[model samples]
Target: MTDSQDFSNLSNRRRMTALILLTLTVFAIGTAELLPMGLLLPIATETKVSISTTGMLVTGYALGVVIGGPVLSALAGRLPRKTVLSVFLLVFIIGSIVCTAAPSYGLLLAGRVISSLAHGTLFGMIVVTAKNLAQPGKEGKSIALVGSGLTVSVILGAPLGTLLGQHLGWRFPFLVISLLSAAALLGIMKQLPPLPRSKGGSLKGQLRIVSRPDFLLVLLITIFGTGGTFAGFTYITPILERITGFSSDSVTIILLVFGAGSLLGNIAGGSLADKRLVPTLFGGLILLAVSMAVFTWSSHSKAAAVISVFIWGVAAYSIIPALNMLVLNKAGDAQELASTLNISAFNLGNAIGAFIGGLVIDSTLGLAAVPWVASVVTLLGIVLAIWSVILEKNRKCDRLPEYPFENRTA
Candidate 1:
């Protein structure tokens, strides 16, 4: 549990404001992060690169997040949380600027990498900050609020950016995100209180977390489960066009439906995870598997496609808060370490998902098979999730103190 004093010090209104501000930060970053997915075609056309090459930009950003997260956290150790956050926002701003103004594919890719350097650290820090701001038991809700920020960007920002890119050019979307990032920075500075610096951090201390099989298994769940979501989602625009027979313009609107589902799912996941962590997690996995499998076949029908996408949206993001809580609990004293690693693992998963999705596209499987592959990957993740739960129970049983008569024969 967080120190009660931390939760008690702030007024409810201020805490809510902090949550809104943190969520906006996520929105700005999330929009920029995913903008490539919606604008993939335009970027490839204008940059004179193949679509496959454009896909690598997404992979590059993921790699940047994985690399930047730990290094930034280590460098900022014991620093003021607000100052560190400000620094990250500045890095994001610079990256967006570079991306927007780049003259060629190489420069655009460079800019994307710069912008992504802030992602992992920002997500990890904001989540920790949001949890601290919540009133004790509402930690999951606060984390979910942050998740909603990211999801809402998909709902609103990414699609809007996509719409804008279709009209003006891909560069324009990055420009719009740059403006959003500036507003988010101002809001975060004005609203967010000084948060406590995390303690007990060191490279050695961080690396030592992998020794815990429970923590490692949870990360594996993250890679495969969330990776499965990315497998279907990262290539969504193409899937809608080639299989569902939707026009590009219609794809934009459908993305909104997907985004709405994400918003609802984020809230439900947060609320339910706070209420009951284990059940919410298991249920979310089950929901994701079913949705992906259905989406594979449902792509043939326009109405069914919409329903499948909405369900996919809900099932996809709903697992985040529960998963984060699970990892935090399993990590014990190394909360920050676990949080940052999980953040990096998410992008690592993204890179893997994108790569796998690309292979499916290039192979005979084509776009129609993406959801099926995603479903299979996610179903496997469910098996790991169940194993983790059983492992946790066994670990707890092992830790029980021996009594005089209990287990005497054993």
Candidate 2:
């Protein structure tokens, strides 16, 4: 083999290694993000706060991500990607450490917010960096691969942390996250190459791109699609318990099944997005709506509920890569800022879905109606997706040169 060919192979190997480290970093971060949910009761008891108040930890973190993502991305505008990643990981480590040592609920909430401030920007940069390092035409796959960490966290990391927290204490989970973050930080500094900053023009220019109708439409789709999923998901445990009449242990097993579905969905979505971006988006949303709709009726039966839940998991996560790719494609030079904004859009969707779900539960429609509501929300996203596609086609056609003979004849 030629020496150049050998060097090319080595370079690919290095990139894969770096990608793996980034994925691991995201796993740690994702685990930290969701860990509080399982430990809420224990944390509430220890901190002398009501369980509802304890739930604020999750809310606060999501709010922090929405508010802090773009702000931090703007602040780090000109910094090297490697430097920004390392700094963000350091901030995450510090926040996790704070959570580990906090003596009161307020302090714990503050630590969660601190950790969350790193979440959006970290994910944005990771997505951008992964795209850059990917082999040609494989950007979608790389993003999916990096994002798989979050799915895996749902599947493995968060559950393991919850188990550890149950045995050791709520603080122990945070402590483990801190250690993981530190290790990831060290790996990043050593294994990752120095990446250049995105050419995301001025902050004002980036904002202009973000405000464009096409981009806004993409964000809307993200918001509605994610919101639709979370609308039912936020209350899935209750739905499983009350409607499906599953035991606590059975619920746990059911969730594992859901996680397995998520992992499979992530892989399938990423692969398909790499090949057919727009179609993947449309199909994913369609499947998501259908799954949620089916879930409404399926919830009454144990076997059917489990089947619907698994399909719901698959449908829910499948659109992520397509949505992310849409942001990158639509944002042009402002990809980094756009990517960060998309992250915020996702978090905003989560808050909206949970809020709407809560409202549905309180109203006469009650818990049984959550799935249908979620299905409707997803259907709205499909409408936006259709509009976006039409606009895209028009834009493409507009770029075509007018034929002089055709114009003369017509």
Scored by lDDT, the top model is 2
Q: What stretches of model 2 exceed 4 Å from their correct place?
A: 1-10, 400-410
Model 1 scores a C-alpha lDDT of: 0.82
In model 2, how large is the Cα lDDT of residue 368? 97
TM-score of 2: 0.93
- Indicate which candidate wins on TM-score: 2
What is residue 299's positional error in candidate 2, in angstroms?
Answer: 1.5
Give one digit per residue, the lDDT tens place, for model 2 in 1-410.
Answer: 31112224448779899899999998998999999988999999999999999999998999899999999998887787889999988998899999999999989998999999999999998988887778766777888899999999988998899999999999998998999889889999998877777553787877787888888998999999999999989899999999989998899999999898888888889888878888888899999999999999999999999999999999888999889987887776676778999999999998999899999999999999999999999999999989987777676579832111111111
Clashes of 2: 0
lDDT of each: 0.82, 0.87
Off by over 4 Å in 1: 1-4, 40-55, 166-169, 201-203, 237-239, 361-366, 400-410
